[model samples]
Target chain A: MQKNYWRSNLKILSILLSIWFIVSFGFGIIWSDSLDQLQIGGFKLGFWFAQQGSIYFFVILIFIYIYLMNRLDKKYKDKSEEKL
Target chain B: MDTQVLTYIFVGLSFALYIGIAIWSRASSTNEFYIAGKGVHPVANGMATAADWMSAASFISMAGLIAFLGKDGSVYLMGWTGGYVLLALLLAPYLRKFGQYTVPDFIGARYYSNAARLVAVICLIFVSFTYVAGQMRGVGIVFSRFLEVDINLGVIIGMCIVFFYAVLGGMKGITYTQVAQYCVLIFAYLVPAIFISILMTGNPIPQLGFGDTLVNSDVYLLDKLDKVTTELGFNAYTENTKSTIDIFCITAALMFGTAGLPHVIVRFFTVPRVSDARKSAGYALIFIAILYSTAPAVSAFARMNFIDSVQEVQYKEAPSWFKNWENIGLIAWKDKNNDELIQYSSGNALEGVKPDFNNGRGLSGERLVNNNSDLSNSNEVYIDRDIMVLANPEIAQLPGWVVALVAAGALAAALSTAAGLLLVISASISHDLLKKTFMTQITEKQELFYARCSAAVAIFIAGLFGIYPPGFVAQVVAFAFGLAAATIFPALLMGIFYKRLNKEGAIAGMLSGLVITSAYIINYKFINVHLNSADNWFLGISPEGFGFIGMIVNFFVAFSICYFFKKPPKSVDQMVDSIRNP
Candidate 1:
């Protein structure tokens, strides 16, 4: 049961971290010029990600992680109590 | 009221607030001194962390840096903030669960070796000192400029204010004071940004104003900026001049380095639960994002306004800010073509990094600098990038009080970070070096006494660095992040996630990372600066980005060594499991 809980935590972390990379490194840096061809309002999509979008996404990602981990902690706590 | 009087009032009130908070929250125990009794609320801790992390560089210089570097400056924006994500996910929660007074304490216990702890302490001291020196210099600059005091006197005054709170209240005092500082600095940063955004683009929100069209016109701010910059022989403001690989590596290095910063990580230990650590990181980023997102906008506005104000304007007709900054030796104008008009183009206007002023005024009453004018370009002006934020309010003709608020805010930013760094240095010395390593019989009261004494000593040394700042101060600030990324981050990350990493592997990894990163930075940045070009950099990665390569090497060396060594003992494995659980 503990192994399952740890596995779940790892899974959540990988998913969130991948999204973080895609926004900041992928859209912002690696493919920034390519994405610059597309504009959102006055900002090129790539520049927005670099200057503004990625920071906002980072905030949201952390909050989501907090919510998910809290739920996971509760789930494991109840299961261990039942076993006891 | 005059700007100086208002500046005095704002600065005086803020100092009074910090000292008052210090006296009220004086730490009685070592726990409170080191980690605020482990009782700070998540949101308040988050605010303190934000203030501690921002520093004077973030508050005053980052926007100016971005203004000059153009799109290439994204490395700092993404690198600094992205590390918080890594910290929240990989390091902070685990470290808080480990529950130690200092980072070295965790290193010692986890590796079961005093040698590992000592190495960690050395790295922490090196990184913290390199960083704190910059903060002290920032305080001196703000005070010398606004309060009209000598720069050395400014450093001394800053030391006393920090010494009062840091030596007495310790972390408990610092945490609350930083919470107040975050409020002051963020407000100071935003007010000017908003005013400039409205003046330039008819948009009050600077973030959106950056993208919006200019007032009474259809041209987007960035589009106009790009056109103007390229026309002046500069790189397009929206385009990257740096190589893509260099940008990628630098950003990665900074991200990992920020996650590894000891002062920032220690803030998580002030919170109550593992969950609060994660939540506090989120809140801290939210607070940080308020300034980070607005910074690019300020950069764009400052660049546009600067160009519009000075380019091709006759020196006799130049604005007061031009001559004011000139008298302070930050900006200079030379009649290069004998035209007497400021032909602000690209390339160096003067022969060196800064202008060496002569004794007399120029033909147009501008400060006469002795540096030979570069004939390569028609540029007649030499403007320091550090002045972009400091001179922004005057350039835009903001109210006197707004200018005063910025001075107070810059001091808050510098002092908060300096106090945080001093606390980390003192704690590592008192707790890790003395109590744990040598004087193991010391009582808690004695440990607390040592902590205060060490903090006072650290502040004095930091003040000296500010007064007699080394020529390499700016270059070495980046080295702090590189060393931290290469050494501390890998050690702590591996200690938590890779349970098989033994003392031999961790120590070997840290030492290798430290040696390689330092050698590369010193070779290129300090010792052989003339050859510090793209052609000579390994893998085309500059010294600023070599830490990423060092980190990779650290991981590889540790894993290989761990394969040969026996696994960590059973009890250590159980301890790792416990931390992983909650």
Candidate 2:
């Protein structure tokens, strides 16, 4: 049961980190020009992603990770208590 | 009140508050000294970490750098903050679970080798000292500008104040003071920005204000800025001219390096539980993001204000702030075309308009023309980038109190980071090297004494570096990220994730990464400075970008060596499991 919890935790981390990479490096830099053709309140979309949007996403991503991990920790605790 | 008097009063009050906090929270034990007794609330620790992480460079220099770099400056905004993501998800929780006092302590214990610990300590000192030099210089700059003190005297005053709190109260004092400093610095940063934003765009929010239309014009603020800058022969405000590969490499390097920085990593150790450390990192980012996102807006506003206000004005009719800054040798203008007007543009057109300090108040109007050598009309004004943030309130015609607040905030930013780095330097020497490695028989009280002594010595050395800084050390601070990313980050990350990463592999990886990164930076930046240009660069990757390459090399060497050689002991594998599980 603990092994399963660890595996899930790793899975969550990998997924979240990949999303971070895609938003910051991928959308912000690599495909920035294409996305920049559009506009958000006068900011070039790609430029906004690089400077403003990506940072906002990073904050949200971390909080989500924190919330999810805390839940996982509680689940592991309850499962261990039942086994004991 | 006079600006000087206002500055003195504000700076004095802040200093008194910091000293009072120091006395109130004096550390009684090594635990308190190293990690604030590990009793700090996650929120308070988050605030302290924000103060500790955002140094003088971030406070005084970042916006100014962005003002010139334009779109290229996004690398700093993204790169500096993105590392917290890596820190929170990959490293912070695991390291906090390990429950170590210092970063080197973790490296030593996890790798089960004192030699590995020693190498980590060497890297820590090198990076921290280089970084603190910049902070001390920042302290001097703020002092010389506001209080009218000599730069050397400013550094000494800064050194003494840092010593009082850092040595007396230790981490406990520094942490609480950092919380206070965070408030002062962030308020100081935002107040002027808000005023300028409202003035420029009729919007209160600086971030939104930058994208909004100008107060009277139909065009967006950025669009207006782009038009004006290009007209003056500068790059468009929203477009970047740097190669994409270079941008990608630099941003990646900075992010990885930020995750690896020891002073920042150690802040997580102050929070109690692994869970708190994770949340604390997020909160820290929220506080940091407040400023990081605001910086670009401030940059754009300042850039537009600077050009519009002074670009083609007569030298004699230049703004009072321009003349005052000229007196301090920060702004210089000459009528290179003998037209008695300042024509600001890009390039070396202003190369010959030297400021004559012989009259003791800088070059006055007639003297400026008499001393001018060239006939070029394109460039006649030279303004230093460091002045952008400090001069913003004056240029915007803000109140005296706001200008004084900027001085206090710049000091707060510099002093807090300097204290944090100085503490890390002392801890590595006293606890990691002396207690753990050399003098293992020392008592707790004796260890505390050694820590204090080492801290004093470190501050003195940092002060000396600040006063008569070697030219190479001036540029070395930029590569602190590169160095930390290459040497320390990889070792710590592999020590946790890969169970088979033995001491030999870790050591080999760290040394190779250190040597390769340092060689690349020094060869181009120092040994053959002319070869540092893009055409001569390795695949056009600048020194700042080489850290990512170095990090990859570190990971490759460690994994390959571990595959061929002995795995870590069963005990070490058990330790990894314990760290991971928690």
Candidate 3:
């Protein structure tokens, strides 16, 4: 049961961190110029990701992690208690 | 009232408020002194963290840096904020569950080695001092310019105020005061940004206004900026000039460094629960994001306004801000063509980096600079990038009270960060070094007293750095981040995630990381200054980005050494499991 709980937590972390890497490093830096060919309002799409969008995504990602982790904590706690 | 008197009032009132908060939140015990009795609310801790994280560099100088670097500046925008994601997910909650007063406390206990703890303490002190020096110098700059006092006097005054709060209230005092500071600095930052946004783009929100069309123009603000800057022989304001690999490495270094910063990590320890650490990091990012996002918009606005106000204008017809900043030696104009027109094009206007001011007026009443004019370019102005944010309000002709508010805000930003760094330095000494390692017989009260004494001494040293700042203060600040990224971060990350890693592995990793990163930085930045360009950089990665390489070295050494050694004891494995469960 402890191993399962740890495994699930790692799974959540990997997924979120992947998204984090993609937004800032992938879009913002690697493909920024390609994305720059596109525009969002006045901002070049790549520039927006670099300065603004990635930060917003980071904030959202943390809260989502919080929601997921808190629920996971509750679920695991109840399961272990029932076994006890 | 005039700007100066109003500045005095605003600065005086803010100082008084900080002192009042300090007195009210005075820490009596070691627990309070070190981590605010572990009871700070998540939101308040978040606010404090935001203030502590955003230093004079963020509040006063960052927009200027962005204004000049153009799109290359996103490294800071992303690198500084993205680390919180790593912190929240990987480090903060686990560290909180580990339940430590200081970061070295975790290192010592987790690794079960005094040698590991001592190394962590050394890294913490080195990084914090390098960072705190920059903040102190920032205080001196703001005071000299706004309060019209001697820079030394300014540093002394800043020292006393910080000493009062940090010594008496400790982390408990600093946390509440930082919350207030976040309010003051953010308000000061946003007010001018909003005013400029309305003036230039007719949009109230600077973030949206950055993307909006200029007033009475069909051109988008960014498009206009891009066109103007490129026409003046500068890179397009929206384009990147740095190599992609360099940007990638630099951004990664800064991100990992931010997560590893001891002062910021200690903030998560102030919260009551492991979950609060996660939640507080989220709130801190939200608060930080508010300024971080607005900064780019302000950069665009300030750059546009600066060009429009100064370019091609005769020196005598220049805006009052031009002469005002010139009086303080931040902006210099040379009549390169004997036309007396400020032909603000691209490239160096003077032969050297900074202008050497002579004690005489120029042909157009500008301060005479002794540096020979560089004939390589037609640019006739030497404007310091640090002036961009500080001069933005006056450049836009904002109200006097708004200008005064910015002065106070700059002080708050500088002081809050200095206090945070000082507290951690004290904690590492009094908690990690004395009670935990050296003098185990010391009581709680003695530890508290030692904490205050160390804090007082740290403030004095920080003040000295401010008054007689080293010429390499700016470069060394970058080194602090790189060093932290290379040493402290990997040690903590592997300690939790890879339980097999033992003390020998951790120490070997930290030492190797530190040696490589510091050697690269000192070699390029100090010893081999002439060879500090892109061509000399290893793998086209500058010294600023070498921390990423250093971090990789640390991880590799740690893992490889661990394989050849005994596995960490079962008790350590269970400890990691418990932290993971929470």
DockQ for each candidate?
A: 0.89, 0.80, 0.89
**For residues B1-582, what per-residue lDDT tens digits would candidate 1 score against the true structure?**
999999999999999999999999999999999999999999999999999999999998999999999899999999999999999999999999998899998888889899999999999999999999889878977888888889999999899999999999999999999999999999999999999999999999999999999999999999999999999999999889989999999999999999999999999999999999999999999999999999999999999999999988999999887888787788888899888899888999989848999798878878888899888888888988888998999889999999999999999999999999999999999999999999999999999999999999999999999999877888997799999999999999999989999999999999999999999999999899999999999989999999998899999998888778888888889989988989
List the RMSD of every prediction in angstroms: 0.8, 1.9, 0.8
Let me know the DockQ for model 1. Answer: 0.89
Of 1 and 2, the candidate ahead on TM-score is 1
For candidate 3, lDDT tens digit of each residue in B1-582? 999999999999999999999999999999999999999999999999999999999998899999999999999999999999999999999999999799999899888889999999999999999999989888987998889999999999999999999999999999999999999999999999999999999999999999999999989999999999999999999999999999999999999999999999999999999989999999999999999999999999999999999999999999987888888888999899998888998999999858999999977888888899999999988998888998999999999999999999999999999999999999999999999999999999999999999999999999989989988888997799898999999999999999889998999999999999999999999999999999989999999999999999999999888888888888888888888877
Q: For candidate 3, report its TM-score.
A: 0.99
Span of ten consecutive residues with least summed lDDT in model 1 chain B? B321-330
lDDT against true structure, model 2: 0.89
Rank order by lDDT, top first? 3, 1, 2
* Residue range B339-451, candidate 2, lDDT tens digits: 76778887644444444444532344533433443444467777778889999999999999999999999999999999999999999999999999999999999999999
Best candidate per DockQ, number? Answer: 3
**TM-score for chain B of all predictions:** 0.99, 0.97, 0.99
How do all models score by TM-score? 0.99, 0.97, 0.99
Specify the CAPRI tier of model 1.
Answer: high
Score residue A76 of candidate 2 by CA lDDT: 91
